[model samples]
Target: HVVTARVVVIIVAAAMVVIATTPVRSMTVVILTVTPVTTLLRGECIELETLGESGGEAFCDRG
Candidate 1:
């Protein structure tokens, strides 16, 4: 009975940890996914700007 109770407690604690961290983990995932895209876009914009293209500002603004 004590072992069963311990097992139940461990399961509950693990579940609670998962539930609590889920949002944070998802946000981290989103940031990780988005950062590279944003960086790539920004790099493209900078390249365009360096090339003295008129559309560079517009492209960066749209991004």
Candidate 2:
């Protein structure tokens, strides 16, 4: 029982460490991935606005 408890504690601690470390990396990856897409979309919206396309106003307003 004692040995099993110790092993369980170690495993839980290791899992906690991995859980803690994983999100920061993933958050950065998400932000990095999302930013370029938003920027590109915004740029496209601006171009559309300049060209006086009908639906361009809606996109720029959303951004």
Candidate 3:
């Protein structure tokens, strides 16, 4: 259930970028893996990724 929520968040963030006309510096959102790598639910890590300024690619933020 939690992982599902993460996907939803990423979708919403992406949509915002599409709807915005003015150039945005960057957009960030959390996404999750489909299959759990851990037995515990909390083990599902949220991947925080940022979209590139060009709007064609994304890079993982270490911070």
The candidate that wins on TM-score is: 2
lDDT of 1 by residue, 1-63 (tens): 345446546655655566577866765655554576566657777877888888767868877
- Which of the two, 1 or 2, has more TM-score? 2
Q: Which RMSD values do the candidates have, in order?
A: 18.4, 18.3, 12.8
Give each model a TM-score.
Answer: 0.39, 0.44, 0.33
Full-model lDDT for every candidate: 0.64, 0.64, 0.37
Query: How big is the positional error of residue 35 in model 2, measured in Å on the Cα after superposition?
Result: 0.7
Q: Give the winner by lDDT: 2 or 3.
A: 2
Candidate 2: lDDT over CA atoms?
Answer: 0.64
Q: How many Å off is the CA of 37 in candidate 1?
A: 1.1
Off by over 4 Å in 2: 1-28
Candidate 3 residues lying further than 4 Å off, grouped into runs, are 22-63
Looking at model 3, the pairs that clash are none
TM-score of 2: 0.44
